[model samples]
Target: MNEKEILERAYLEAQKIVSENSFREFDTSLCENVDFLIDKIGSNKSIVSALATSLLKKITNPEQDIRLHRTDFENGYSARSLDTKVVTPFFKRHFPKYANKESAFLTLSTRERIKWNKNEGKNLKIRSKALKRSFLNVFEQIEDGNANPRVYLNYLFAKLQALSSKDELIFQLAKKQSGRSGVLNINLIIEMLQRHFAEKLSSRLPVVAIYSIYEILVPNLKRYDNKRLLPLQVHTSSDKHGFGDIEIYGDDGKPFEIIDIKHNISIDADLIFDIIKKTTTTSIDRYYILTTFPDGFETKEIEKAVNEFIIQTKTQKKIDIIANGIIPTLKYYLRFIDDYNLFIKKYTNNLVKDAKNSTEIKTFHIDKWIKILKEYKINNV
Candidate 1:
């Protein structure tokens, strides 16, 4: 078999073994199939190797551990200002030149270094701000087709793997003292799959969300209407400012409302209020905020704020917030099809890798994504 076929076969075998067994117990007795797959690590690509190893380690399924992951702790896990007052002070005292950062020694790729610089700032709050900006920059690049989110995500996953590896003992020491709520003592895949991927993809959430929902709707529409809904350029910038992250086009293809998606462990009220204010300048129907944040009093408060905005300004558009739990499903769809297609299109070509085609469809089990949705507890959505 070709390398891709071999990698796919090994990946599937390992996944099937994990799927059929309880994750906690699955780790106790790695089956011969998975053991062999894990042993063939040197041959497969990084993603394939990572997936295979994840299967053996009981990391693929979300059921194994604390699943819903957050990107930042808001505070650096310690109210003592461990990140700023403690860590930064220590660095400034002894390693004033290096600031206790590794960048003083190693050379990071120009693009990669910018992301690195964001993590080391004056304080945790500043660091968080920088982190968010850097993430949005990458998200914009992903939206612009200038960068691949999966590749960036894999870079993060690789970091997690390094932290977990025996070779990285110092990280264990750091994790102990750092009360980083974002970094939990659980499976690496959970953080990578549920948190990193979820958070990053959510930045461009509307694009991927619409694409996933479109594909799902297309097959059903064909089954019922006996016609195909050909995909079109769903998003277009209204002008230099751009109409939020998404535009709800009317029948005439003019934007009717500005649409945006924000996925966070908890919804921040100021963000919603800011979004509502921006919609007032548009003649759209309403500003739509789609989020994965669980329903709560805060969500209701967001709705109440929009109502108050209508009462105060008497604008043409209103604000609608939906915290439907479909963000995870949307992310899964992107990973399987959209992101996969992007990865292949960017790195490979027509003569080489194609997951959407005939033989590959079976070899790769691309349609199995449907089964994942059905078999898994997507009812939360």
Candidate 2:
């Protein structure tokens, strides 16, 4: 196919991929229109370059609204938002430095680093001129009509992979140490995911709460037909106690099962009883009390409570137990977040490199980061 045909087809394919997988709706019509122009121009490299130039202008102009929006009611919102805060800032700050330096070090044909000598009034102009120069340089190298499309695509993929690697390194380092730094790193990951990719993934609850629900439900979900489960937080009122937290539904959305997650040091018998009593009239299949302890606890204490509840109710609804020390789980989660932050940092740096390598400025890598938290062990009594 000619250059025009090639550009048109590639742009269309890119549009399809973005629309299908992107977390939000974007005006990919600019890309589509650019493709149409390329097709009309036939196969000249200059025409193809002009079309790409136009496409970049549209993407960078900020005329289109690319920001994602979602309702506050969803469970995934908070966690995802939290994750984004953790990752994006670090990436934005460090990306330019890393990319420019790396391009210089590697001596890549498509990458260049222009030195800017600062003078008080000339700082802005110098920086702007350097940026424009870098943008054009990278585009000229890649748009030669002979460079493999995969080369351009691979650049994007490589940056993402580097970021992931960097995150893993940071997490490992934190695992060996402790204090505020680790805590801050963990929080960063939570913030980054929440901000960027939370809307795309399922659940609108706070990430920690959602994770707690997932930890307890995953095994049960796997045991019973391997169905996907939805976590619900419901407040209920009973005849005696007025209103309290109760088990309202099972993993399968069935009426009979109820589960509650508590982050308290010890599970309160009165609270459990209150929940059970309130939920008594409802179609509760089973009752599960999942508690996370900062330090480990005796399962016997929880068993005693469960046994007492079972005897008192004399009801067929089974009582289950989930009691565990959550420090290790927290550690694991923190590690994941750190890794993600590092990933974003490195990825953004790569973009900076691309920007500095050309005279034509283009912005890329706009997808928000998403974290798929792994399931950890639960101490079942």
Query: Considering every candidate listed, which one attains the maximal lDDT?
Result: 2
* Candidate 1 segments whose C-alpha is farther than 4 A from its true place: 1-207, 214-241, 251-253, 265-269, 296-303, 310-381
User: Against the true structure, what is every candidate's RMSD?
Assistant: 21.0, 20.2
Residues 1-381 of candidate 1: C-alpha lDDT, one tens digit per residue: 533233344434434433453333432222222333223322212212222222222222222211101123331122112223333343234222213221111112111212212333122222234333433333233334334332332333232232223212432222222221121221322222234223332333234434434444434442324433233221212112445544445555545544465544454556556766665555555555555564522567765764465455433334444433334434443443432323212211211112211111121121222222223322222
lDDT of 2 by residue, 192-246 (tens): 4344323432121222333443444445453434433343222211111222123
lDDT value for model 2: 0.33
Off by over 4 Å in 2: 1-222, 226-228, 231-253, 294-307, 310-381
For model 1, where is the 10-residue window of minimal lDDT? 102-111
- lDDT against the true structure, per candidate, is 0.33, 0.33
lDDT of 2 at 202: 17
